[model samples]
Target chain A: MHIPDGFLNIPVSAGAAALSIGAVSLAVKKVQKTIEDRLVPLMGVLAAFIFAAQMFNFPVAGGTSGHLLGGMLAVVVVGPWAAMIVLTCVLIVQCLLFQDGGLLALGANVLNMAVIGVLCGWVAKKATNFLSRTAAIFIGSWISVVAAAAAAAAEMAISDTAPFATVLVAMVSVHAIIGTGEGVITILVVSFLKRVKPEIVEDGACRAL
Target chain B: MKNRKFIVFSLLACAAVVVFAAVFASSYPDGLEQVASKMGFENKMSGINLMGAPMPDYGLALFGAGPFSTLVAGLSGLAAVFLATTASGWAIKRLRRSGNG
Candidate 1:
């Protein structure tokens, strides 16, 4: 969920932006040391794919629509570090080119969807290690979407933009349904990549995925 | 995976999805937008967007507000992101190589 401008006050937006910048800088450093040269092109392609996929929104309920966030998919395909970069790239393009999300809120959007979302997905997958890979992917993707939404809601609430309980409830309920789409898509994509391009999987920074 | 083949496949997939989305995406407001509308904060959206995007709201002015314009917008966005990311990857590679050297 892309937060538009004026949704949160300046303080929250600036705080999120600062956090996003710090996280992205860390990810950039980590990726420089760990990212395989062969996976570079794949990272770019995955970013483009995520950008394209985000364009298509399916109806969730009551006229609300949700699209694939692709955070977990990116993390699984690449790694948390590179995935964050990919997502930041996607978010930047979306803001600068399409005006889909607010430029003022770009930092908050990136923080929620890229850094927090990917990290939550990675954590979820690791936590569910006993589960099958497919199941873990599903759960991880779902958790990532819901967690991002929750984080956004908390930011809004903290900003006094909306009532905390109401915003949290609305966001979580709608995102839970939206998360199912993310989970399914993630599983399919990971499975397809694993089948057709096993080497990419083997060579990825996140070997577990 | 073969690098060339992977590149081709990825581009093709992105192109296909861009075309498909241009044709099939729902015009309804997304989750956040919907929530904003419901919570009566929809009017609160106001700010100086840093970029005066050539195609604001993913519609091309030259093509008029129609499916064709949307298709053009989607394809152009797809191309832009693809090139941007590719260039970014190239830069990162160069940086890594220089650091190693």
Candidate 2:
């Protein structure tokens, strides 16, 4: 979710921005340390795909719509570090070019999706691989969306944009359904990639499918 | 599939989504927006975009709000994201090379 400016006060926004900057910088370093040759163009296409996928907001329930956040999807293709960079770039482009997100809240959005979302998804995938490959990716992806929404809700609540309990409940509940859609999309794409180009789906999770 | 072919396929998929979104993206407010509206804090969104993006909400302001405008804007965004990430990846790889050398 791209947070708007007024949702957070200056301090919270700045704090999130600082943390986001650190995370992005670390991501850059990690990618530099060891990046695969194929990943160069692969990252390009994945970024484009994620950006495009976010455009179609399918209606969910109660007059709410949801779109593919793509953090977990990107992570399944690339590792967490590169996924962060990819997501940060997407968020930045959305804010600067499309104005989809508030410029002042860019850092917070990046923190929520690029940093927290990717890592949570990666951890979930890694932990649950024993269950089944597809299941792990699905569960991991669902968690990523919920984690990002939770983080966003926490930020707004802390900012007094809304009541903490209610914001958390509302955001989480809506996103839980949205996250399933995310999982389905992720599974569809990852499965397609795994079938088409087995090596490309690094998955970064243990166990082979 | 070759890496080259896969790249082409994915790019085509990206373009397909953009065009699809141009024609049929849902207008409903998303989860956060829905929550904000229900909670009566949607007004909290200042909606002040510091950087006036040429294409706000995937439609070019210069052009009338139409499917074609969205198609143009979406393609532009897809290209922008593709190039930005590609450049970043290249820069990182180059830096790594020089560091190791």
State residue A87's C-alpha deviation in candidate 1, in Å. 0.3
> Among the candidates, what TM-score does chain A have in each?
0.95, 0.95
Give the top-scoring candidate (DockQ).
Answer: 2
Off by over 4 Å in 1: A202-209
Best candidate, lDDT-wise? 2
Error of 1 at A10 (Å): 1.3
Candidate lDDT (C-alpha), each: 0.85, 0.89
List native contact recovery per candidate, as a fraction of 1.
0.70, 0.87
CAPRI-style quality class for the chain A–B interface of candidate 2: medium
Which lDDT tens digits does candidate 2 get at residues B1-101? 98788889889988999999878888899999999999999988887768877888788877889999999999999999999999988888898888742
Lowest-sum lDDT 10-residue window in model 2 chain A: A200-209
Instruction: Tell me the deviation in Å of residue A103 in model 1.
Output: 0.8
Per-residue lDDT tens digits for candidate 2, residues A71-165, read 98888777788899999989999999988889999999999999999999989998999999899999999999999999999999999899999
